[model samples]
Target: SSLTPRPTGGISPIALPVLESLFTGNLQEARKLVFSQMLVSGQAAENGGSNNFIIGKRNQRALQVLSKSVDQDNCKTNALLYGGMHCKDLHRRLESMGYVAKKTEWRTAWSVD
Candidate 1:
């Protein structure tokens, strides 16, 4: 899925809704729910006979950033700001992955290995 756009030097819009959902509900509970969803969804995919393809290097870095930012101690505001930083990092990572194609094409989508 495509990441949502963030304001320049700010949080991505995609994370905002998640933050809102976390706050309006129980944050830890929400995390547990999301984790469960990921697990169950992954299992469903596996049961459907999907092969476990290696994640592209760029995606691995992105996941790392996400994991670090969305820790249990981080609050909504912290997470929002962290996600902003992570999005910028992801941009650089994607560029290094050759997905940016050209320096001028950073905003456009490109293929991964």
Candidate 2:
């Protein structure tokens, strides 16, 4: 493929794998990004919260299914797709994590760098 970038505008949680690697090099930045993502999860992940994350604004069941979509490939199709459409709540989670989003003819893509 060409060297052209993905038009990620800014950092995105979608690049979790990259961030994880970056952590070894720049621990501060990596921690910041990861912490931001945790906050964005809306789970707060405080001392004693629900400790559950929702997908597609549905229920815990959706989170269960979405987890399946987050395998090695990290394909979010099933997580974002609800009633044959994109899920706002799920997308918001990305936004809250400071991930830049881009809308294309095919689908909404996010990236972080």
lDDT, each prediction: 0.48, 0.50
TM-scores of all models?
0.25, 0.24
Over the stretch 29-105, how does candidate 1's per-residue lDDT look in tens digits? 55755665676576556532223222234446555565566565463433212222235445655566554433332
* Model 2 weakest 10-residue run by lDDT: 46-55
Clashing pairs in 2: 11-112, 12-112
Candidate 2 global TM-score: 0.24
Using lDDT, give the best candidate's number: 2
Q: Give the local distance difference test score of model 1.
A: 0.48
lDDT of 2 by residue, 32-106 (tens): 667657655643333233322323336345555656667655985643444312244555655665645777245
Q: What is the alpha-carbon lDDT of model 2 when measured against the actual structure?
A: 0.50
Cα lDDT, model 1, residue 81: 24
